[model samples]
Target: MTIVLGFEGSANKIGVGIIQDGKVLSNPRRTYITPPGQGFMPSDTARHHRSCILDVLQEALEEAQIKPQDVNCVAYTKGPGMGAPLLSVAIVARTVSQLWKKPLLGVNHCIGHIEMGRLITGAENPTVLYVSGGNTQVISYSEHRYRIFGETIDIAVGNCLDRFARVLKISNDPSPGYNIEQMAKKGKKFVELPYTVKGMDVSFSGILSYIENSVEPNMLQEGQFSCLIDRLLLGGQETLFSMLVEITERAMAHCGSQEVLIVGGVGCNVRLQEMMAVMCKERGAKLFATDERFCIDNGAMIAQAGWEMFRSGQVTQLEDSWITQRYRTDEVEVTWRD
Candidate 1:
């Protein structure tokens, strides 16, 4: 009968969600979008979150048809995100906890995504490929932690895509990465790009730099390079996704896992899901994925993870509820899972 209210604003989006036990009662979010050729700044993103968080919280409660006193606990992302945005969300979460007289819990953003994926897809003990604007990692549960098997040594895959979008001056309404994915579908040719995978880890910065330096200046002043842009977009996706698949396969083999679950914002990309599905089929493994609803960052994920933790007797004290910008997936004690 436990109910939890969760807040998430680790990056450009702010969300509020209500969860009762394992079922999500409501999940609502708002994204802070910048114009073309620009990435969101931390301060601006924080300001956007601060402006809309209260409204979103009201929306969540109304959608869930629950009163504030019905909630048993409050949860928020404790970070591994933009510092200002994370702090903004944490402030609201703490204020609500105190005003409502509820216990507070701090959750890892990565674990929130993982828990949400498992909840929506029902994949047990699967190898996880977590890709987002801020993170990229291959993980599996070992002993008591979600151990990282491989990761990006430089920028994340989604960050690489967003930077490339800026070079192309594409729209960032929904997201730069989403626009890139749509453009890539129209591509007919493949342009060679750098493929840098070191052992189990992958690197994306070199490839992004190569594209910006080598191909970006070739476009005509009148923007008549549509075909070339599509080619480059598709080629970049293939190369980067191949690198991810390679590392994920290696980790799956090492861990003897027969199931794969993809989580995070980039997991919403159809192309990445298709590529992973191909590998999963070849290896005779099952693939589990969620749509934009669960894949993209949201507060329901935080609530879900917090519900698990609270049920297992894990709660954060008010003095220790501060955010950590570099919180690793493996650092959480994972007391909820056997």
Candidate 2:
């Protein structure tokens, strides 16, 4: 049984995991949540990542009761996230590999989420609707690839929620998505919000502007668009989350798959799961969801993917390994199948 240690410093979280064969032995995360009123700054985010990666890595090793030298291979997220965060993981992995002479592999962040969900739920071939603050994609497994049949054309689903939450003056702690989910429960009216779905590709920039500007004028005139804002308060989050659920259900139907799998950070929402459950139940299709522990950005998924690849002798070299902020899921051939 080969043991693989994975590091994920993509986005705002630093995650580390240890996996043996296909079993996830340990997974831990350290988060560097942006305080408030700040977008992702490469330098700042990278520094934060560097600080957390060591902690999470140590935590994973401790949880698994193993040392770094015991790891047969080391894997890290190579890109599709902030450069600073990417560099943080790369530097550590590079140092560790050089010291211990372990095989180092760089994995794609997006595919890591999908593969982790597959490992957790044992889904052989399920259509995927992965929605996160940074990404929104409708995926299907085909021809040794997880193809993106549909995705966000502009602005990720999670970004839309974060920005909208900021407009609503909601706290940026824990997570913007979680805050929106809570607010939505208290929301009453369903004020109209832009819903744009074009040819399976979604866009949220227009909708964001519509809400921001519409409320801006109201606030200037009558002190606030109190009533209009109230309509959107919790109501907007529910509508947006519901819209995503509806789209995923439609995409699953289009794929003609009997099983649909939900992955990514947003998939943890109970509301999202409830909506998909009802839709899938009506169609006699199976829907699988990963728990919060496995959902969101984490190293368990990376370790899981690395374990499978390691078994097939698929490994990366330290000399030519590189990070990409735009890596696609279908680029690498998957060795595991159901």
Candidate 3:
């Protein structure tokens, strides 16, 4: 049984996971939350990760009941994330690898989410809808790569939501997005927002601008605060998720796949899942999505992807270990999958 320890601090969270021969042994993580109406700064997030990394790793090891020497390989997310946090985690990964004399593997963040989703849901060759604060892409396996059929042309879906939440001064304890989802449940009316879907690409900055400049101020002036905000939240989600379902269906049609797998942070939204379920039911397709624990960013996903790469004889040299902020999904050659 090959044992792999993985580190994932791509953004605001520090995660540590242990996996053995494709089975997850332990996955521990902690998120850095800012005050209401504030966003996470890259430097501060990196500092938070640095402070909690050792404790997170120790907890994961203890939970898995494995010694550092038992790990055959060390893995860390290498790209497509905030630079400061990524670098902070990579430093820890390198140190651990050097101390334990274990080989290192650089895991792509997006592929980790996709592979972990597939592993947990048992969905083979599904068209993937990956939506997060940092990324949004409709992908499918083809020609040894996860090809992107659709993606956000501007800001990501989760980012749009987070910024909108900040405008409303929502608490970021669990997550701004989660708080918005809860508030959206009370909405009954539908407010019109721009739904921009050009070709397979989506755009949310326009919608966000409209919300911040026109909608909120108008509602506040009209003295319909609670109802208008609820309407905006719910209606915005409905419209955005409709676009997601539409693009996902189009990608599925193009790929000839009946299974739709939802991954990444925003994939945990119950409303999105329900919308997707309806779409899949109508199209005679299957919808696959993991719970919040696996849907959001975590070390288990990185460990799962890294373990596969390690089995395929993939290793990252210390000199070649570098972080990237713009790593694409198709850039990684899926050698572990047939």
Candidate 4:
């Protein structure tokens, strides 16, 4: 068996996985939550990746019961991520590849999510609603390729969550979305908020503006991280989070997809998953939610995507491949497409 060691040090997570054929032997992820106004910034993500690389990689190898010598190839996410973080992963993979004398492959970050979503849900050719800190896209298949039917013109769904969490003085220490999710679990009363979508594309910047200007300042900054304290301290977090659930459901509705697949870390949100479940059932469609490991960034997904690409002779050269901070879903040439 030709084992592929996958390394994904993109965004806030350090994902390490070992795969043979198409199966993941291990998919461990270590996430980093940036301070407010710093999410996905190159420098911030680099520090996180640097801090966790060795441990995360070792854990994955251990879980797979394979040594560095056993792997046939090393795969790492190469583009469409924070530059410094991408470089950090590249450095590790390059060094390992040089030492092991193994082949190296650079994978696309977004495609990893899609590939892993396909693996977990067994959804072939289903429409993908990929939303997270750096992306909000309504995608589907057409002409043998993944197409973006609609997407965010600016901010990503998870980024909005983190920024809003900061408003409530929520610490992203463990994870910002987790903090906001905790608060949303406790939030009650439908605090009115902005929901913006244009021609199937969604916009969260408006909502961010509304929250920053309209909501009371975060308590921790001046008082504490409770937006609900302005009204009722009880169940405020739940209420705020439910609002996000509602918005996502609304986006799904706007897409009119019967087979809805949600991918990304925030897609692991129970409330969000529940909301999608409810809406999908009501619409007579199925919703596939990747488990937490697949939901978060992971190297296995990158390897899965890379394997597909490699088989199709889509291997990228080090000279031609550069890190992309703003790659659109439509930019990739899908060789696997019909």
Candidate 3 residue-wise lDDT, 257-330, digit = tens: 99999999999999999999999999899999988899889999999999989999899999999999999999
The C-alpha lDDT values of all candidates are 0.94, 0.80, 0.91, 0.73
Residue 99 miss distance in model 4 (angstroms): 2.8
TM-score of 2: 0.93
**Tens digit of lDDT per residue, candidate 2, span 223-323?**
54445445665556656666676677777878788888899888888888888888889989989998778888888888888777777778888776788
Question: What TM-score would each prediction reach against the true structure?
Answer: 0.98, 0.93, 0.97, 0.86
* lDDT tens digits by residue: candidate 4, 129-170: 777777767677667567776777878778777876666556
Candidate 4: worst-modelled 10 consecutive residues by lDDT: 230-239
Residue-wise C-alpha lDDT for candidate 1, range 1-338, written one tens digit per residue: 99999999999999998899789999999999999989999999999999999999999999999999999999999999999999999999999999999999999999999999999999999999999999999999988899999999999999999998888888998999998999898888888889999999999988888878855455735566666565569899999999999999999999999999999999999999999999999999999999999899999999999999999999899999999899999999998889
RMSD of each: 1.1, 2.4, 1.5, 3.5
**CA lDDT of 67 in candidate 4?**
89
| Residue pairs in candidate 2 whose N, alpha carbon or C atoms collide under 3 angstroms | 80-325, 133-158
Q: CA shift at 262, candidate 1, in angstroms?
A: 0.4
Q: What is residue 304's positional error in candidate 3, in angstroms?
A: 0.3
Question: What ranges in model 4 sit over 4 Å off?
Answer: 33-41, 216-257
After superposing candidate 2, which stretches have Cα over 4 Å from the reference? Answer: 217-230
Superior by TM-score: candidate 1 or candidate 3: 1
